[model samples]
Target: MSKRLSVETSSAAASSLFQQCTPFGMSIISAGFQRSAQLLEMSSLHPEKTREQILEQADQEWIPGTVFLVDVDRSLAVQHEGQSDIVLIPQPSKDPNDPLRWSQTKKNIQFAILFYWSFMTSVATNWNGPVWGIWVEIFETSYSVLNDTSAVCWCFLGLGCLFLQPTAMTLGRRCVYLFATLIQTLGNVMGGVAKNVGVLYGVNIMTGFAGAPCDSLVQISTTDIFFQHERATRISLLTFALYSGSYLGPIAAGYIVENNRFGWRWCYWFLVIFFGALLALQVVFMEDSTFVGQRENETEVEKEIIAQVISKEEGQVYVSASSEKDQNVTVFEEKDFAAPLDIPTQRTYMQRMGLIERKYNDKRPWWKIFIRPSLTLALPAIVWGGFVYGVQVMWLSLIATTQSEFFSVAPYNFSTAAVGDTNFSSLIGCFIGMFWGGPLSDKFVAWKARRNNGVMEPEFRLWFLILPAIINSGGLLMYGLGVNAGVHWILPAGFGMGCLGFGMGSGGAIVLTYALDCYPQLQSEGMVMILFLRNMIGMGFTFAIQPWLDTDGMVTTTWLMFMLSVVFNMSCLIFIMWGKKWRKMTKNLYLKFSDPHFFL
Candidate 1:
């Protein structure tokens, strides 16, 4: 009977172990356990294993930006890198405070505030376009001299992005948002009372410096609060903010200047008032979205081994086992280890409103982070993406600078308000572009992914660019040729301008989505290079538009712009075919940047 009881006990132990490992899709966890076992067996739980080392091992085979977006077969339940049943990219951590896990209402509220700032600040910045002719008369300056003010602003806009983003990364995003608002408000106040072109120059400088975050921080915040699939739409909204404000600001400024009561100076005063209101809203609602996760001190293997030991023995525990020594020993832990992770207490409302979140303690030096953006230019794909959007910005600058100069004294002889009204068509086109660039692109890519066994490539974004490229390049030809022929204002302003607006809105979305999807490591830095190249090209064209118009005549210049736009915009075809090969070539560099601690 005793012998029979021994046999039954052994059988029971074997069944319990088998049952423990039988949960559905538990094989994924077991694979990780195998890695954890190998980790221990290699060095008997080396205490000095750094977070970077662990991450490098975990990230062995995966390429940057190549992700399994959808599960084609029902049998597939978990992604190797992420635990989500639905395969959400940038998988949400269990921490309740992670922005990814925030409630939809909370996420929407925060994003709405960011979108508002992007729109209104752009409005304040570009109000000068409609008033350029009026400024020429009042300040006794040439149109080129007036355009120089914008040229200065564009230069500073790039510089501001480089300098301010590091601070935003280090101090917290909200601090920079508040600081920029204060500076812009000051600039607008000066613009209202300015007596000369020099004062206007100063106004542009300050405002441009303040507006840098519009490109860099706004994109970072978008990525922080949204998932991979969701980001294209939200980023497109940011592009819309830029287009609408560029077009609408001049419209608002035109009417304000045309009013008998307000006059041209009131454009700045109106911005000052609006900016004051924006500052208040931002303070109340634009919560800092920065979150850098901390690595656990203990490994999964450590947790499993320790849980079998006494809870009292865990004051400071170290497990040292070696095949050479033929013994396993668990001793005092040198570092305190918390029990398995549970959702930490959620922050109170006041805590969330604090200027900086307590958890954002990235130990990398601020200067290193500042220089990182510059290093990204070495990536060939990044450089190519910059040229694509840089050309689009070149067109935008042309529209803003040329419209007042062209129509203000043409056969059409448009008044200031009428010049502003041209932008209404641009605005309408932007609305359509937003829908095409954002939701439609997302759904289409998703459908394509389903067809491709549920694997989505970053290059998938470039496929839709074909439509935008043709429309945009054609729009340039129409606007230029129409102006050269001095046709009715309706054709160039309505159809041509509308087509340009569509390109700006849709093109911005596609290029931005593609670049970030290709290299999401430190997204702010990745975007900085693109915008830097964009602003530099924009600044160059801002200075060149008039000279070119004078030197080559309207017809020749128009043809030249059409061709330049065609070459840059249509290059998406080349990328569409070979982008995956390029990505594979850069995979090592991408992996280096993706590591949070790689620089350190």
Candidate 2:
């Protein structure tokens, strides 16, 4: 097709051409439709005299995540990124308002908001770690008591998604993100003035409730603005933001606690200040990424037909009228064709900044969306993802719960500032790990896809995960064992913490990317289920940590954690081996969940 849809054609001729075009589903989730095997059988112009005519000819068929990425034949019509053969997945539509067609400057601004939000959410939750000792003294409570409050907070964090995500789906990402920030701001005010454990409990619970989006909503927002190919790198950067805040928060908290003038309470105040500023930036600049396109009124079959005809017209794929006699033929004769002219228009700035850009024909009630996570939990892939990510959280929670107790009393006799400074090691490790897992992994998968004749399997990325599994196990041993052995502070504080942070950074990012890839249509619900289970698991581990350490001591507990990390992380092998098989088995279930519109 001609690059410009402005080239008009006769209505009757366009109708006849569309009728002959094969059926393919439009995701309604993207500007460019995501092509897959789910395409329906359709009538063709070619006749079936002795045998059926196959208009489409290919050396190999494509699958989900698989596309003519290299465009080796270079016959595909859509615009390629730069001069590269890489075809944009979920091809961008002509609509200038489409999120997929957004300018780089616009995308960066959107991404910055999400990245900062995730970063601050993590920081707010973890900054309290360094101050736990001081709080314990001031509140006349034990470390175990404070840890229990945190366990409850984890529960709130997980459960918070049940309410917030559906509202995001019903309302729009803009409002939910802003509300989350507001809640966090108020919770910090509560925390800054907590005079007793009861008040801190409220603070912890409120923070947990507000912080839920860190695990799920930010992910949904990321996917809204990025394509499948660009997702890994972007998610990795956001993952880095999450961990940077997590590890860095304690460092800041430690310094604050050590300084009498500013004090630990300033930690809460600082969050109030920065996140308040973030909320303001968002109020002014955050535009809703949701794009309601032309297919809103079309039936499934019609939508698919409209979508595929458009794809064929765009030249992403082609059909050849070949039978057994000419089966060896591989030729694609491109012809100029026009795309549908009716497209969504760009919204006014006021409309763009509106708190709710409700989906067109998005009639599902909030309760229907609320219950989606339960159904999603049945998926084996999401369950496994939860366990992997949850284990990573368990390690972080363990550090928060034990950092002061372990470092403050002992041969090392570290002060609050020293304990805080230890976070620098994890921060360094997270940066490196995110590089390896995020960007390197993205390159690795694309390479694999090219080698597989431009076919990409979500599982291609899982192979890289094996390294993280091994790294995570080693880190657990180093941290727990080194701490118990009372080796040099560097042994446990630096190497152990560094490795743990590396695993946390790398493993969490890869697993999240894999899950979303497997079920792009269900990103929100899948994430809701995954984060819920992950936090619950983190909560259970948190509740158990004090007792487990008390009963088993650091040595046995270290071994236990070591085994847990190795086993859960290596579970990726199961998915790596049978993940595709499992996906195939659950295909019907997946379709039912994705419904008329996929998340893309």
Candidate 3:
């Protein structure tokens, strides 16, 4: 009778354990329990061991959730020789197939591909701006109309993502990337052959629509593959590539249009060729990083072990069945402790290419994907990020739209090639920011973590914004004053542009990294919010700047821009001080709106 009572208690405990383990509502618990019961039976021979002792033993084992064997206090620390202090947040899984577990070589390759794609797409977006001067004559359109074409394209760039990002979530990112590239390439071809300004306008809109992913998707992909500690650095690199392409495109276009042989149309042709190459590279290299489902099936014993480990880590005591009646039940399975470094070959190349490994079952209305991101604009951090980037975009548009006129008719009398060459200063600044921004922010976070007993918060990254804000404001003032005073053109073109690029690049990195760090679950949507505000603000500025300049003159307009920059840049202080409080306030809202399956 006593034996029967013990067995009944054991069965009840096992049933309860199975229920807790199967959160996804899988019915495989019975099968798993059968395997677990067999192991428990063997353990029944070891009656002397207490439940506490068993759990203590399990805690010491190198289980998934257990304190890592390398360091108990710093479980997330990597085993590198010099960088042992650097802890990887959102600790990488032991699974070989995990993207975070991928080799550094593979990660670098992926980064390169993403970087190149971002650079090329940005080049495509702005290449038309510098060549607009020549298109005025060829297309028989006024400068305002041609400028409007570029502004429309900028707006479409943001609007396209509303639809495309949802498709990326439903269909795989790789598929969306391929499709967008194809559309962009075709659009470029059409633009190259366009006979009239209307055709050019339509093609520009098409290209902008297709190229939208370049702004947001690449950053999302970076987050997908990299750990929290690595994201800021990778994002900084991506920002550099993006800004490089933006600054370089106009330079190349200016010269391309100036060349009598190739002329303005070749600008679009160049994009066609570039995107065609990019499309091919993406097909061969980019793989779907989206999680379909768990691919590994652990036996019941393994499941029990994992459960015990998780419970131990969470400070929950797990009383085994044997513990109820002083039975010696010790279940021990030989653990595979080796870390699998090589990529698994479970899926065939055809399956990878087809993206058919696991079909995503996103039941949300398709339009919700489009609508949800726009709703994120209400979030303070998201809005702040958008505002900071939008101001920068306004400045960028001001330069791109007005530079040709500024240089052509001024005391400088810069040739098209010289105008193009002037972008080198901006490029240099971007490089500086790319190198300086990410690592410094990362180090700041790490240092702060060290000071805070290893508790790292997202707000640590925002401290770096102060310098960038001041530098950007100063640069705008210098450029405006230099241009108005007709100080040697180099003063405005080189020093001013360089400083502006550095500030914009660094500022962009800070805000983006902060947003991603704060709400990683909503990264894609948050990015969309930033993109929408950025482009819309840019379009507004592009439309208003010419008229504003006519009325207020260059110095007043530029000083106004500088004041606006100061306001936006200085807003980072509010985030740094109260960002945490804001995040806490909006936590329920984010949980309510965010897709649970995202980053699965």
State which candidate has the highest TM-score: 2
lDDT by residue for model 3 (29-96), tens: 66677889987986785444545665556434322111121222533213311235444434443444
Better of 1 and 3 by TM-score: 1
lDDT of 2 by residue, 443-529 (tens): 998888778765568888888888888887898888889988888988788988898888888888899999988876678889999
Best by lDDT: 1
Error of 2 at 87 (Å): 2.5
In order of appearance, the predictions have TM-scores of 0.82, 0.83, 0.78
Model 3 TM-score relative to the real fold: 0.78
Q: What is the full ranking by TM-score, best candidate first?
A: 2, 1, 3
Is 1 or 2 the stronger prediction by lDDT?
1
Distance from true position, residue 283, model 3, in Å? 1.4
lDDT of 1 by residue, 169-264 (tens): 787888899999999999999988999999988998999989989977898888887877888899899999988999999998889888999898
Q: Give the whole-model CA lDDT for all candidates, comma-separated.
A: 0.77, 0.76, 0.72
Ordering by lDDT: 1, 2, 3
Stretches off by above 4 angstroms in model 2 are 1-70, 77-79, 292-341, 359-361, 596-600
Candidate 1: where is the Cα deviation over 4 Å?
1-61, 74-86, 294-342, 597-600
